[model samples]
Target chain A: MAIATDARPQRTTTVPRRKRVRRTKGQKAFAVFNYAMFAIFALICAYPFYYLIINSVSANNLSALGDVRFWPIGFHLSNYGQVFQLQGLTLATAVSVARTVLGTAGTVLVSAFLGFMFTQERMWGRAFWYRFTVITMYFSAGLIPVFLIIKGLGLTNNFWVYVIPYLVQPFNIILVKTFVESMPRSLQEAAEIDGANILQVFFRVYLPNMTPILATVAIFSAVAQWNMFQDTLIYITDQSLYTLQYLLYMFINQANSLATAAQNAAGGSLSSIASAATSQTSTSIQMTVAVVVVLPIIFIYPLFQRFFVKGIMLGAVKG
Target chain B: MTTQAVLQEAASSNLVREQENTLKRGSRKRVGGKPNGKKSIGMFLCILPFLVLIFVFSYLPLYGWIFSLYDYQPALGLQGSAFVGFQWFEMLVSSPTQMAQILQVLANTLAMSFLGIATSILPLIFAVFLNEVKAPWFRNIVQTLTTLPNFISWVLVYMIAFSLFSSSGLVNSVLTDSGIITTPVKFLDSGDHVWITMLLWSLWKGLGWGAIIYLAAITGIDPALYESARIDGAGRFQLMRFITIPQLMPTYVVLLMLSVANLLNNGMDQYYVFQNAFNMQHIQVLDLYVYNVGLTGNNLSLATAIGMLKSLISVILLLTVNLIAKRARGTSII
Candidate 1:
C-alpha cells in the first residue's frame, strides 16, 4: 500500500507539439471575435458581484430600484450596520470561528488517522477497510438516514452535530492516502532498524513529512465546515446553536427578521421598518452575506493557493 | 570492505537475533505477555477519536436505514415504529405521481448536469487560448478574476441572477428601452428559461475553478512536443488538436469520469437558493425533491426510501461507467 511516488516526479515525455501559426485575415477576425465574446461573457459572469458591492453601500433609492451599478451614488454603511444590529454580527462571527477550528481539527485528525491506518502494508483486513470506506464514498445512506442516525445516537441539538457526522471525509482520506502511500519506504525501514515500531514510524517519521498536504487538506476542510449551513438547519432546532450560515439563512428567508433588523436600526419606527423591510429586500443583502461568508476564504486562500494546484494535479495524475 | 567482514557482520546478526529472543520473552513477561503491546496500544489510542466519530455518525446511523422497512415515527423510536418491509419502496414505485416526479427530477438533473458539462468545454477551450496569450500580467489578472465566482456562496449567486433577470431588473429595463417587448419577460418565472438559467449560472460560477485542473495538465505537458510540431510546420490548431489535446486526454478522462459518477448531483444549494415557487416545477432536481419530501414534508420514511433508490441507481451508473472504461479504454475510476 505504501507505493512511494513522491521521489519520482514523472519525467516529462516529448511529443509532437503544436505551433502558434500566424492567423490568416479571416482567421484573425475570428480570433478577435472569440476574444470579444469570451471577454463579454466573463464580464457578464462577474458583473453581479461587482454590482453587489456597489449596491451594498449605495443610497436606498439605488438599491430599492435595483439601479446600483459601476459605482455607488453615495456611501451609506447602513445595511452593514443594520445586519450587525439584527444579528449581533460579532456573535455569529465568533460561532463561525469556533466551529471552523473545532470541525477542521476534528476532520483532519480523523481522516489522517484513517488514511494512515488504511495505507499500512502489514495491517490485516486491508481490503475490508478499503472497501468499507470506498463503499460509503459511492453509496451514502442518504441524508434522512443520516439525520435519523444522528437523532438515534442523540447527537441532535449538540455542537458535536456539526463536528461529528462529517469528521471523516472519504475524499480527504483518499487524498491523504495518496500522500501517505507516496512517502519513501526507506524512511520506514530506517525507523524500524532504529528499533522504532509501526506507531513510532507513522507518528514520528510519516506524520511530520505530511505537514504540507495536511495543511492543504485542513484549508479545504475548514472552508467547508465554516460555510456549513444546511447541516445546522437540520440538526440544530435550537436558535442558540445555529452556525453563521444558518443565521444568514434565517436573515434571507425570514421577512420578520428583516423587519426586526429595520426596526432595530431605526430604534422605534414600526411603519418605516415595515415599509423599508419588504421593499428594501434587494439582492444586495444576499450578496452582502456572500461577501462576508466568503471573505475569510478569499483572504486565507492566498497563503495556501499554491498548494491547491499541486494537490489537484497530484491527485488526478496519480489516479 | 572485505568478504570476511561481511561474514563477520552476518555472524553477529545471528548472535544478536539469539540474544533478542531471550530479551523478547523477558519483555513480554514485563508487559504481561502482550508482545508489541505498547505499539498496539498507541495505535488504538491514535485511532480512537476517528473510531468514535465514524461509529456514531456513519456506521451507527446505518441502522436507521431500517426506516425504509418501517412506518417510522421519530417520537416512538426504533422499537415502537411499525415494520412494514419494503412497503414504502413499493409505494414509491406504485404511485404514478411519486414515480413520475422522481423520473422528471432525474431527467432534469441529468439535463442540467449535461448542460454544465457542455458549458465547461468552451471555458476549457478559452483557458487554453488564454494560456497562449503573450501578456503575463493580462493572463494572471484574468485567471485571478475568473476564480472570484468560486469563492462566492450559492445564495449570493442567485441574488445576482435575480437582480439581472427579475421583472424590474436590468434586462427588463433594456428590453423596454429598446421597445422590443411590451412588458417585462418575467425571466425568473419563465419555465422555458429556468433550466437554462441554472446551467448558465452553474457554469459561470464553476468555469474558472473547472479550468484550473485542465490548465495545470496543459502546462505540465512538455513544451518540446510543441517545438517539434513547429519544426514540422504544424499549425496552432493542428498542434492543439494532436499534441495538447492528446496530452490532456488523461486529465479529461478522469474529469469526465467524476462528472459522470456524480451526474445526479445537480447541486441542491444552487438550485434551492435560486428557486421560487414559480420555477420550482422546472428547476426541481432529485436532491431538491428529496429534501422537500423528507425534511420539508416530514415524510421521513418516504424520503429515506427515495434517497435509497437514488443512491442505488447512482451507484449502478457509476459502476457501469467504471466497468465500461475498464473493458474498453482501460482507464477505470476505481
Candidate 2:
C-alpha cells in the first residue's frame, strides 16, 4: 500500500533492463589503434609549445645550441627578468590587454544589438537595411584604399584605430542574427506583453539567452584583436602604441639586435656579465618572446573551449 | 460582370480594413499613441549609426579605384593627381616580362588555392574518426590541443617553425647527432618544395579547427541510422562509410563553394611571415605582390589596378557560386 508513495521506483517499474553488449576483438583492436594515434597526434600538436617553454626556461648556451630539446637542462628565471626590462613591452602589453577587452565588449554589444534589430520585422525598412549590412560580408576594399581611409580618418598612430575601424563587422552580425533567430519567439513576446519596450525586451529577455553566441563572438574578436599586428605594422609607427604582438614581431624580425635593444632599454648601464648573457642567440630571444606572446592565449583558452564547440555548432546550424 | 465582381470584393475588403484600422487605433491609444510607428523609428535610429559607419568603411573605398585611372603623386594628393586613362592596365600587359610575372603570380595563387581545396577533405576524415572515439573526455582533450594552433597568430606559428626546423634547431640536431645525416637540413631556408611546406604548415595550424563543423554535423546525424545498421549486422566502419561522410557532404560542399569563390585570396599572413630571399620567388601570392608593388615598390596605381581586377573577379565568382548553390541545394549561401 505504501509502494505508491515511494519516489525512486518509477524507472525500475516502467523501463526494460539494460543489456551489456560485448565488444568484438576487431573493435578492441581498433580502439587501441585509435587511442595510440590520438596520443601521437596530441603530442605533435603540443610539442612546439613544450619546446618553446623548455628552451625559454633553460640556460641560454645549451638552448641556443639546440641541445636543450626533450628536457630543460639549466632552469632559470633570468630570461623573464631580462624580457620584462625590454622597453615598450610593459606598455605594449597594457595596450594589447586594453584593446582586447574594449574591442571585444564593443563588438559583442554592437553585434547583439544589430542582430536583435534585424529580427524585428516591424522595424521600418528592415529588409533593405539587413541586406545592406549583410552584403558587406561578401567583399572587401583592397589594402591601399583601406589604408587611405584609416589615414584619412587620422587613425594612424592613434590608439583608437584598434577599436573604431572594426566596430560594424558583418560576419559577427550574421552569427548573432542567426543565433537570435533560433531563440523562441514566445520569450520576446512574453516580455513585450508585460509592458517591456524594445530595448528592455532585448536587454532583459534576449541578452541573457545570448551568452553562448556572445561568448563565441567575444572569442573571435578577442583573438583577432590580441593577435592583430598587421594594423600596428602599417598604422602605428609610434612606439607608445605598439601592441604586444607587434613588439614580439619586432623581436622576431630583429632577433640579433636584442642586445642593442636591451642595452638601450636599460639606458646603457647594463653590467658586463649581464650584457654577456644577453648576447644569447636569436633562437633564445625568439623562443622567449614567443612564449610571452602565446601565454595569454594559453591561459584563457581552456575557459573558452567549452563554449567554442557549442558556439560553432550554433553558427553552422544557421547554414 | 467582371468589373462588378471586382468592385464588390474591393468594397468588402475596404470595410474589413476600416474595422482593423479602428482596432489598431484603439490599441495605439491604449499603448500611449502610435506605438508601432514610434517603435519602428526608434529601431531605425538605433541602426542608423551602423549604416553610416559601414558606408564610410565598405562602400566609401570604391572611390579609390579611380586612382588607378590617375597618375598618382603622393604629395599632390588624390585630388591634385593628374587624370589618366587605363594606362596602368595597358602597362600591366604591355611588356612580355611584366605579363609573365603577373602570370606566375596568378599561377602560384591557383596552385596554393588548389592545394587548400585538396586538403579540405582531411578535416572530414579527422572528424569521422574522432567521432568513433567513445570517451567524451578524451575527445575533448584532443580537440582542445589540436585547436590551439588556430588561436595563435601566424607569426607565432612561424616562430614555432623556426624553433623546431631551423638549421640548428631540434630536428636537425637530432638527425645530425644520430648520424642519419652529416649536415643539418635546410628546412626553413631552402626554396625546395615551398608549396608543400606551406600546405603542411597550414594543415598544422588549421586541421583541428577545420574539423569542428564536420564534428558538429556528425553529432546531428540520426542515432536511429546507427542502431538500425547495428541490428542489421553492419559494423562500425560500414556504418561510418555509409552514413557519416554522406551526411557531412552538405557542409563540406558549402565550405568548398566558399573557398572556390575565394579562389584568388591565398591569405598573405603565413606566406608573408615565412618569406625569405630564398622562398620569395615562389611565396609571393597576389595579395603580397600587390602589397609589395604598392608600398615597397611605390607603384600604387599599378597595385590599385591589379587589386581592382581581383575584387571584381572575386565578386563575380561569388555570384556564380551563389547561383549554382541555389540551383543544386535549393538555398544560396549569400
Candidate 3:
C-alpha cells in the first residue's frame, strides 16, 4: 500500500475535517440571527413595490385605501384605466421605448468599438487618446455649459438629444476596454494571422466573446434612458417630445397641486370641496403611473441579473 | 524609498519591458521597421468617431465655460456679450444675499455628502452578513430584491415615497387606523430631519448595489484561510473578525477614499425629485442650485461661474485624495 503524499498545504486537508465538525452553540445562535436579519432586510427592500401593486388595485375611496396594508381591499382597476387615459401618455411612452432601444444599441456599439481600438498597442497616440477620454471621468464643465453646447448644436428639442450626447460614455468605454484586454490575446492574434482586418476581428472575434459585458452595458444604458427625466427638464421644452419620466414628474406636481387646492377649500363652499375631493383621486393615479413606469425594469432585470453582477465585479476588480 | 518600493518598481519595469518585447515581436511579424501603417490608420479610423464625440461633447463644454467670463446672453450670443472677467465670481462673494445662499447650499452639499461617507461602511457590514447566509437560494432571492431599487429611477422612488409617506398614504393611514398617532406625520413634506431622511433613502436605494463589490471581494477571499482558522480552533465569529474583515479592508478603504474625493459630487436627481417648498431649504445641493440659478433664474454667467468653481474644487480634491492614497497604500487610483 502506497501512502499518498499530497503537495497541498495543511489548510486544504483541514478544510474537510473542519466541515465534518459539528457547529457550536454560538454558531447556531449566530445563524439564527443572520437569517432573521436578512429576512427583514429583504422584506424592507421588496415591500414598497408590493405595496404599490396592492394600493393600485385597492378601492379608490380614501378610507378604503387607509386600511390597505398587505393586500388590496375592494380590488379595482379604475386607477390604471385613468392613468392610461391621461394626456400625452401614449406619446411619452413611444418616446421612452424608442430612446431605450436606440440609445442602448447605439451606446453599446460605439463604446465597444472604441474600447477595442484603444486596446491595440500599435495604434498612434494611443496613450494620449486614452488619457483624453479617462480624464473626463473626473472633470466636467458643469451642466450649464453642456446645456449651451447642446442648444448651439440645435439638439435641444431634437429626438437625438437622447441618443447623441450619450453615444460615448467614458466609464462604459473603460469597462469595455478592460474586458477586451482580459480576453486571450491569442484569439485576436489568430484572427490577425488569418488575415482578418481590424473591423472584421472586432465584429467576428471580439464582439461575439463580449456578449456578457455588452449586454450589461446595454441594460445599464436602457435603464438610464428609460428613467432619464433631466434631459427633458433641461433641453426639451416641447410637450410632444417629453419622455415618460418627465410626464410622470409633471403628474406628481399636478397631484401635489390638486391636494393643496383641496386642503385650501376644506372650509369653503360645498361644491368646491366636492370638486377638490374628486381631484384627490390623482394620488391613486400617481401610484398607478409609478407601477407602470417601474414594471418594465422589474420584469427585465431578472433576465440580466447574472450578467450584471459579473460585469460589475469585472469592472470593479480591474478598475 | 523602502526596499519593497524599489523591488516593486523594478518588477513593474521588467513587466513593461516584457510587454514591449511582445509588441515588437508582433510588429515585426506584421511588417518591417515601421508598424503596418494601413492597420494603424484603420485603428485610428475606428476610434475617430469617439474622439470627435469626446471633443464635441466634453471638451466643448470646457470651452463653453468661457461664458463665465462674459455676460452670456442667449439672444446676444457669446460674441456680442460684454466680457466681464471674474464679475460673477466677484458678485458671488460680494453680494450679501447671494453669498448667504451659496454658503447655505455649500452646507447642504457637505452635510449630505458627509452623512453619505459616514454610512458608507454599512455596505461592507451588509455584505459580510449576507455572505454568512448558508442557503444559496435564499441569499440569491434577498440579493435580487435588495438590488432592485438601484435600477429604479429617482422619479419612481419619489413616487413610492408619495404613495407610502404622504399625508393620506399607507403609512399614515396605518398609523392613524391603529390609533398610534392623532395626526399624520409629514414624512415627505417636512424639512425637519431632512438630512437623516435623505440618508435613509439613499441607504435604501444603494445598500445592496454598493455591497456587490464587497461581496465579490469576499468571494475572492481564499477558503484555505478559513479552513486553517477553523483548524486552529477559531470559531465562526473569530474567523470572520480575524480573516474576513481584514481581507475586505483594502477594498473598503479604497472605496471610502474615492467617496471622500467625490464629496462634492452628490448628483441632483434624488434631491430634485424630493424637493418641495418645505424641504427646498435643506434639499437644494450644489448641482441643483446651479440648475435653478442658471435656468430658472436666468443667471447664466453666475451659474457657469459657480459650476467652474465646483469643477476646479473637485479636481483639486481628486488630486489630493490620490496623493493621500499613494502615501497610505503605496498605490494611487488615478
Q: Report the C-alpha lDDT of model 1 over A180-283, residue by residue, as the tens digit.
A: 76677678778887999777877798888888778867877786777677777678787677766766666655645675565555564543544342323534
TM-score of chain B of 2: 0.87
**C-alpha lDDT score of every prediction, in listed order:** 0.65, 0.77, 0.78
CAPRI classification of candidate 1: acceptable
Residue range B25-104, candidate 3, lDDT tens digits: 66555331135443366567778878998898889899877999999899998889999998999999999999999999
Across B1-334, the per-residue lDDT of candidate 1 in tens digits comes to 1111111222222223324444664544432123443334444455566656666665665666778888877788778989889888888779999778777887888888787666546545765666555445555555666666765566656556666777766677668768999788888766777778777777677676666666666766776677767678776667768887777666555556556766776657877776777778878888888888888898888888888777778788889877886786654555
Checking candidate 2 for backbone clashes, the offending pairs are: none
Q: Which stretches of candidate 2 lie over 4 Å from their true place?
A: A1-29, A182-197, A200-205, A263-270, A273-281, B1-39
lDDT of 3 by residue, A127-190 (tens): 6787788667667899999999999899999999999989988767767876777688888888
Per-residue lDDT for B211 in model 2?
80
lDDT of 2 at B48: 95
For residue A287, model 1's alpha carbon misses the true position, in angstroms, by 4.3
Provide the clashing-pair count of each candidate structure: 3, 0, 0
TM-score winner between candidates 1 and 2: 2
Worst 10 residues of 2 chain A by lDDT: A1-10
For candidate 1, give the lDDT of residue B112: 85
